[model samples]
Target: MTMTFAKRSGLSVLALAVALTGTASTASAERNLFDILFGNRANRQRVAEPPRQQPATTPAPRVAAPKISAPSFHDYRPEAPVKVDFAAIAAALDEEDREGGAAPSPFLEALAGLAGFDLRAEKEVAAALVTHYERNPGFIWVEGAGLNDKADAVLRVLNDASAFGLLEGDYAVNVPLAASAVLDTPEERRQALIRFEMALSARALRYARDAHLGRVDPNKLSGYHDFPKKPLEAAAVLEVLARTKKPAAYLQSLHPQNTLYAALRRELKALRASAEKEIVVDTETFVRPGSSHPEFPKILQIIERDADAAFRAEHGEVLVAHAGSETYAQELVPVVKAAQDLHDLNPDGIIGRRTVGALAGESKQARIDKVLLALERLRWHPSHLGNRRVMINAASFTATYLEDDREKLSMRAVVGKPSNQTSFFHDEIEYVEFNPYWGVPRSILVNEQLPRLRRDPGYLDRAGYEVTDSRGRRVSSASVDWNRYGANIPFSVRQPPGPANALGELKIMFPNKHSIYMHDTPAKELFSRDTRAYSHGCVRLQDPRAMAAAVLGTSVDEIGREIGKGRNARRDAPQKIPVYVGYFTAWPEAGEVTYHADTYGRDDNLKKALAKVEEIRVPGS
Candidate 1:
């Protein structure tokens, strides 16, 4: 409890007490007040009274109370000059505590036992629980020997964890038996209450952390994954659990608040509610409009199941005609085209790989995996991706510029191949360089160029690459001993700014440790493909001038004019724009969920990692 002091007669009672009575007790009261408002002042006490150090050291492990501001007395007034007796107020507080009595509290005892509770999560979680109960020891779930309404609410939320792409068992707990049923002894009742209290706290805290910061540490999943940890204060979770009347709503609110996550949730719900059995179509080659296939009946059945009722009725004759036909007749083209359009395909009625993938629509289990993986990965990034951002979705092979959560511009982008996979991270765009020099990375230098250099020492020179020695001196490529280096090279190789340069005209630089950024590529033909994964690691933009203009806060003409006068020139962006190089197999686009092929097999990797993490979170379950 805190006491607020108001000023009287141009000085506070504390100050007046100090002035009137120069006793240590009065000074101690003032010091205690300061400590309560700010933090512990043990250092001041140690300096004032060295003999009291022994007693002060005993309370060292107790967590400090949160600092609160002192109440202001700006409008305070008194009808008449009144005297405030600080001692009387202090005595009254003490009397109130004495009246309440220091009876043994079973709840407090149970909370104390949490120090030894085996919370099977991270060490930080246990530490957080300690800090939480140390600050304010109280029960948020159980009441007496039985569960309360708040406990019921939390249990309901935990049971529905599957809807949020989480396992219910992770936060599951057996409800304590009713007082009339099994608690035949006082000790048993107390033990039941203790288990109920500690288990609720552990599960609630775990759910809070998993819903907010995600369950799996992305860094542990794979070498390609990189994400900074988001802090989850356990004390704050306890505060919410103790205060909020609507525990169910609060638990639901822990999910990622974004359009993509919401869409995925809807997709998950729809998929699970769907009663249609999955149909597996087997095909060896492209099934064109007029080409015959053994599985044409299965394909038509899939279209009929997914298409609208009106379409099904209209195409009922054709469907019956091709119910078991092995030939793909011309009459069934419209039906196949309609299904293709619905699945976001080119509507060419050509059952190519993408069309086949769409027709099959991934097994129900596979779709669920994609949605669950997407939800977990979405939690790795910020909920609000700022008003201005360039998001590159590697799975979709596209980059979109968004402002105020609305797509401002979108363009095709070529990402890294599976062997040289692009990383998943976010950074700010700092500058854009025109006629940029391509300083070859060490991976390309050693793994690619070194062998070529070993065979033809003058290869780099013929390719118009400038070579430098270890001391940054310009050297001929033929002068270096390429055989000496195996995995790494001390010398650097770079290409001067030219039309034939790999990085093309301009490169948007974020300058991260991965050396990945959005750049213009001379290989424009790669962007025309359905799946554009060809770069070593950097994102290659199809329209570099438009991206430059967007980041620089200029027009395409202005960007072109700057590029025309470019002699390896660089221009800083007016302001930093955030860029997210992300990978999502299932994502929201144009108010609908669009599922893409798991390009780097990240979905499988993440799914395996999630299973492994769950095994650790709940050993047997």
Candidate 2:
């Protein structure tokens, strides 16, 4: 019986070793293995004799025939061995091992589907969402075709978005149960989950961004507004939400933590709670303290209403005595003065439009509007405006220096007029210039000075302005052709340091692109006015020496001494002090929210802008 051979396991082992080792050529190794197992054609004649003993051996020796040559291993030389990639081979094996190619993760597919939605316009948000889940490929808000506790927590925080001055409707989202009621199939249920998941993430991101950076983009309000719109990363938001046990707390943490913001929120709550009807005083005529007017009784009533409880207790008799009188009585003067003081006015007891606006106090809705506006404006600025800084509120016509968040100095200020609105922005106070030369701004030169210079070419010369050509060389203002320039003049104009200088004795310089600074003004009487928007654009501090001292971290006497030298000199502040030039119609002052006239109508503009934003956010609204 004959047993035919088949390819054994050893053949596969030999082939694997040959591929792995790569030590010799493939052809020679295979041939040698075959020759070793089964005799080659050339060596077939050589046969082994069994036990015939010496007779058999003698018979084979007698047949010494043709010479035969065997294959030699020493003569074989392998060419360069091919390099093998173990990792690639292992990966190929892994692929072959997997039954069907890995199925796409349904969760990841839902995340990628965000690109097809409205998020396409919100590029930052889309990118962040995709990146977040790719890093953490798991469902956060959903669990097994329904919403999880985390989603419930997020919705709770979003429902109370108004507490942070954000509109609840902007972050409004419906629960997946609504979708579940409409769909019965498993695929539709999954589709509902995807929709629910994306919507939640989008709303959470919007809330996170709006809470910290404000709903209204300050830049879009008007050219006068300047602020860097802070970006909120969606990935960062999702990462925090996924990791935190208290999702509501994490969501609420997005609001600004500044004291002013906190105070505004409290004021908003109070205004919403109050039932007092707003008093409307429509008279354009000014009511002097002692002068009688037809509307005096009405003005008195409004003043009494706006005054604090303490004022009412202390001067209850005075208010009661003039309660029905038409004349602006001496008894009623204190009441008007107290109301003016409460609202941060001149407190001169002259009931003009500004005084009336203050005394009448805003309608509940109006005050709430201002508070909400103030809160939004606060969000535009840094949360922590360093320990030592200066805050200039243009609407209130005041400048304050705070050290360690405590008021160090507060004084009256004159800001830009309506035509030349002081910008709403922030910068660092770098230095103070004593007896500073005022470079006539191009705007002033083109609009005001050029027109004068055209009528009389020697106006600047008469006005004591120093004119120079494009170079630094001083040139006669009369020599230049006034008609040759429109807005772009080759000549530069500036006022030298003198008593008649526009900037009085000293100017605190932050050196911004707006060319605005806190400076002393020759026009001291402007600060006495009820509304002090008089400068070209810079802030005119009533007490420049005191402000200088505060920013320089020195004494007022030292600041006075520097100016007394009567020379043009600049003194750098001890450290850079933050100076925020802002336009806040409602601000916290002396532990109370003081309302100011919206001189530039920024509040109205902001109101309109927000309305448009809401309309876009909620299409039918």
Candidate 3:
């Protein structure tokens, strides 16, 4: 039978060959096994035996092929072939790596990644990054291969966009290519670098000017640069610039003869001189007892102290404390007792924490700041202040009649509650009414009396309010639903002209959008309180009849006669008085700063806004 050959498994043959290779003739045996596994069956039958080979007489000298070198991982160099000091290069690499650059230029790293690229292309991108850094030294460094790719990509975009020039429209090309250039001569390159740096500086300055940052007067800039700087002066200069059409011309005119920009220079010099003068005066002056500089004694202080004490006695502890000694309590006691005489409080020597807090807790500096703010507000007031005036201090709860800036008479007043604060404004007293019938304001009718009327239908009748129909016939208060009546009440409720009426004895009218007027309230107990917030927005005088009599230049009886006749007394008075409702936390009284509570809490709001403005730090600062 003919011997047939079959294909052998490569794994099985390799294993047999490995086992056979340990014996002599192992190479020949392995070759035979490989031929048997690969040769066709018909061919295997006819296969010829190997020819007798000549045995080697001597072993040839073993020769080894040249060792192939693995690619060097540490031999990376930039395409530009720039000479870099290893230490400096390493430090820069470390910094760049720390900042994110692990591959090439920081700008390229910022670009993140790019697939298609060449060495020369990367070098060009590196150059642009160097230029950008030179232009904007303030720019923060980014790191990593990703960042490098990003920066290079962005640089390419910029270069393409700015092919014609460095700057285009509002944008500018900034790439620092020269930083990594390998020049033939180091000295010449160094000189060129210095020139380039100088050009960059000049460009930066020009950019600042174009941006209007350098529009400020040079003198003002110098003033800001100087020691003990008055920073607010710079703001004032800016304000002046805003108000004027030509800021440069305005600055130039401040020094026509090329005098060192006189406005800022002169102002700064004056401020310094004033400061020196103040220091000298401060050393020389000896403030007298009860003088304004150190302290001032007033009757109001005593009243405040006693009032505080009374409050402390009633409640467990005093609300506020005096700044100085306990002696302020003693000093305040008598004065408070005197005010108590007017306010109907019992005279007492003990001035509690509340009273002392009210009197002495406020500092002089706080008062000055308030006055300054008020002065700023006053700048927007109208220029034509009337010759004859009535000034009402809403804080003090008092009004003064002034003729030619001289006080004619002063009277007590009851102002609005802290929540319903009296508005700060001026108005002309056009008319006055004696024995005026009360025409209730809509707000008062809706908010106050309506609720009471809803609960007790007899509220109006008990309060002497007479409800009348269109035909002037009296109507029963029970017929109305006070809650719904605000919308449906067609008839007017008029309080008859009597001393017990809501408007008291008189009413003074001034036309304003707020519907605010001066009148007298039947609630006499309100005026005796120190802090009064009793009125429904309008001002209530302690003695309205006296005020009306003074304004009309007539006797009280004649005013009563006019009202009794019910003639719409349209008599033209000889003079029209100006009335001002003002807010003043601090004012000069006996040459001292007299501080009052910020009853409306306006000071706190203004203070917070001012603090926020101060926190901002601009470039120069």
**Which candidate comes out best when scored by TM-score?**
2
Which residue pairs show collisions in model 1?
none
Error of 3 at 228 (Å): 40
lDDT of 2 by residue, 30-71 (tens): 644554456333234323311211212222222211222211
TM-score, one value per model = 0.76, 0.77, 0.45
How would the candidate models be sorted by TM-score, starting from the highest? 2, 1, 3
Worst 10 residues of 2 by lDDT: 71-80
**After superposition, candidate 1 runs with Cα above 4 Å error:** 1-101, 108-121, 243-250, 283-291, 300-324, 328-350, 619-621
| lDDT digits (tens) for residues 353-472 of candidate 1 | 787788876777777888888899988987766888888999998888887877878888999888888888888999999989899988778767777787777666646677786788
| lDDT measured at residue 144 in model 2 versus the true structure, 0 to 100 | 78
Error of 3 at 229 (Å): 35
Candidate 3 residue 468 C-alpha distance from true site, Å: 4.6
Q: Report the Cα lDDT for candidate 1.
A: 0.73
